[model samples]
Target: MNPKSCLNCGHKISDEFCAHCGQKTDTARITLQSLIKSDILGSIWHIEARFFRTLKHVLFGPGRMAMNYISGKRTRYYNLFSLLLILFGFNVLTLHFYLNLNPDEISEGNSNILEFFSKYSKTILFVIIPMLGTNAYFIFKRIKLNIAEHFIIGTVSLLGILIIFLFNDMVSLVGLWKPAAKIFGILDKASFVLFILFPAVTYWNAFKKSYSKPGLLWRVSVLYVLMGIESLAIITVLYRVF
Candidate 1:
């Protein structure tokens, strides 16, 4: 084959792509079709590293993923805070559909907790973040992670819980039928177990990823207990004060 002169530069190219300069030999001038197909879709989906790839990394290695993102190598995964906000909206919306609870029912139900959440969603954010993060900070303090990174771990745990909780809600929806309703009582309780277990599992796995050891289970148990206590306390205060 004849060696072609580089179009971008005067360098002679022996291969399809230039060795000195990274331009391809067959590269064409910029065009609308290439721009729309390659640049636009590539930018939107991040075709190099898809969302599910990122989700897997986040799930399997929550601490590492958060550390990579916090340390500025963020392009491989979704933005943790932004993802929490979006998934939170999906979770709340899914709950609304399943419960079929109207605004009045939410307000006038047995307790004002639902109403408080509706009106003060941001407030709940503040409460949950601190409660979860504080517990993690106390438990994981020996590792030398700062408070903000602890919050990232907290968000990862919450995100895991919310994702599985939404799946539970969908399961209950299908189980709402007459025949399925018979088994829903069992599944309903199971869902509650999942609600607790998903976070517990992820939180433990996160710290486990951070510090590899078998004996961290006891510390995570205490952290989970403290998280549950803080969550219940906040809900109780909101219930009475609302």
Candidate 2:
């Protein structure tokens, strides 16, 4: 039998994959069934599988997951920034649709901290992630992670926090019904507390194996102090601009 030329790179081959470019041997004409099965569903399944796997680690052991990525055990995980962007996009949709949130609706008189946060949560998160990365770099200097690696840890921690935030938003959607309105209000109030607590918990889980309880507490305290300073700086800038 003659060797079949690879449709992708025109290399002659008998194997299942192209040696030159690694395209599959069966590069037949595109059909509806093939497109749906191989292109659409295949891509979705791949992304979904990796996304869930990454979410599991991000939720339960973000620090360790970051460490694993830093140490190069990364194939099992989805791209962190991509996942962050997806969550951020979803948050935007939920804010608009589920919460019926509008920045203009927040009157100047009611532009308190929480209102400010709701108005600018996405911007705040974008600025704060890098600041938190910087804090981690300095605070956990003994861990020997570089600025980028520290940033990865910070991103992973924030991803977990965002997941919690997303869940809260989802449950708050249930609160929209008349019977659950009270519960919704309570959840809305509790979100601020969770926002503060989740990051601290994520960092602790990430670094618990690395630091003693007392040692970790003081470090986390310093981290939060840095975060507060950063938050104040952001708020000041926003207030001046707006």
- Weakest ten-residue segment in model 1 by summed lDDT: 101-110
- Which candidate comes out best when scored by TM-score? 2
- For candidate 2, the 10 contiguous residues with the lowest summed lDDT are 98-107
Instruction: Count clashing pairs, candidate 1.
Output: 0
Alpha-carbon deviation at 142 in model 1, angstroms = 1.8
Top model by lDDT, which number? 2
Candidate 1 colliding pairs = none
lDDT value, residue 83 of candidate 2? 95
For model 1, residues 138-215, the per-residue Cα lDDT tens digits are: 787777878887787777766666666667767777776768876876877887887677656666655675655655
Residues 1-242, candidate 2, lDDT per residue (tens digit)?
Answer: 89999887788989889888989898889899999998999989999999999999987777778888999998899999999999987876776666364454345676575566777787888776788889988888888888888788878877877887787777667776779889887887787687787668767877888899999999999999989998988888986776
Clashing pairs in 2: none
In model 2, state the lDDT of residue 181.
Answer: 82
Q: Rate the local accuracy (lDDT) of all candidates.
A: 0.70, 0.82
